[model samples]
Target: MFIAGDGAGIGGAKAAALAGKIAALDIACDLDRLTAGDRNAAARPLRRRLVKERAARPFIDSAYPPYAAALAPQDATIVCRCEEVTAGDIRHMAGLGCLGPNQTKAFGRAGMGPCQGRYCGLTVTHLLSEANGLSPDQTGHYRIRPPIKPVTLAEIAAMAAPEAIEKSKRSNVSTQVNG
Candidate 1:
């Protein structure tokens, strides 16, 4: 499987778009939709653009490093606001031999909140890394669990009902016609 954008470590919209294009070209070549030569020809420009987009990251990082407060928050400071997990709590987990963010969940529910680690994943990783004397790579990220919203029984029933299906089709047609 081809991973692109932030998953591939290339951030920013333009860079992600370029990465996506490159992946698409490679996938097309693999599927024989395009020859290897054609794929390379198409990807050359995308790679150049991706490089240019990534080049600015160093300057931006140097210009504006992470906030010290975020990197080293007070013990009482809530790092994972959704779960109300404190920086000190994460440190305590590390002291207890919690090696990574995933382990932190068992210790204090740090990455088990509604956001599922989107907001606090990096901070938790950093805290664990620092406390355990491990690199961020070694103090790995959360094993993501997708957030599930509470669904009502009526919602489930509506999904399978023929009347609901007919209503949905009519609504779609109305929206299309009105637009």
Candidate 2:
């Protein structure tokens, strides 16, 4: 636990070099001692600190770069991976006078995928809004019709609950909708 840096009255390049070497050697010796120990320190139970729900966010957010330098899916990259539509494609639609997200969706087929509009809707809206100089609210996302499927009585019956079937039988709740 003894520090060897009595740097007082010691001046010039030679003393500076000696001091640096001594410091480096001291650090190296400490590292050797630590490594040579029983290594049982790691076997000790970890002291877990209780973190509040809101307190965790600052630690998580600090790991990211500053807002301006933060990374995001780039502009020409394929954003709607489901439909294989690039951000540039949606932007190009905007350039061609495509007004809103739905228009971009219709033109580029970006939001029409297995996940319906959920997957690509946000990316399409952001790109479309940015490209056309409109707000996100203005560039409205695609109108999602349910997970595109042929609705038949048999299909409905298979998926419907027993309670729903009995309730329907008791009342005229029309399950059919005009496709």
Candidate 3:
């Protein structure tokens, strides 16, 4: 491969042939009129801006004021029901003994609420994890069962035949057998 660039426009044939073998190509008409240092200095600001914007923002739960406030107040109206657990309550439970979401729920009644912790489960886990000194992953998310939102017996009756309803009940039971 050969590259010869002088006054006249860079020869396209030569450029195409050397393209693959070239490691870096700088095109500057009147190349000798400007020094390499001058070009590099001009690129500094662009390089700086790229570096500044490349950083990632922290996770929502990690930086939000509401999250910090929630952790500070236990009786704070826990937003989710499935997990009757509150940040403050979990903190209290952690002080007592249990250190995990499952244990905390079992003994403290946290995350066991009606909503089943769906809305507040993650928040509760985040708070409990911090309070109990557990990892976020260790808090383990809640088991989302069928009919995540409660359905009334009447609703089930209206939707299915008696046998179907009974089968649903059995299936629901089987679904949660290990849960």
lDDT of 3 at 172: 94
lDDT (10s digit) by residue, model 2, range 40-100 = 3321221111122224446666785334311125666786777898877877888899887
Q: Please, what is the whole-model Cα lDDT of each candidate in the order they appear? A: 0.88, 0.61, 0.57
lDDT of 1 at 122: 88
Q: What's the ranking of the predictions by TM-score, best on top? A: 1, 2, 3
Provide the lowest-lDDT 10-residue window in model 3.
Answer: 20-29
After TM-score superposition, the amount by which residue 157's alpha carbon in candidate 2 deviates from its true location, in angstroms, is 13
Candidate with the greatest lDDT versus the true structure: 1
**Per-candidate TM vs. native?**
0.73, 0.44, 0.39
- Report the lDDT tens digits of candidate 1 across residue range 26-66: 99999999999999999998899899889988888889888
**lDDT-best of 2 and 3:** 2
List runs of model 3 lying over 4 Å from the truth.
Answer: 1-67, 71-86, 148-179
Candidate 2 colliding pairs, count: 0
Q: How far out, in Å, is residue 11 in model 2?
A: 67
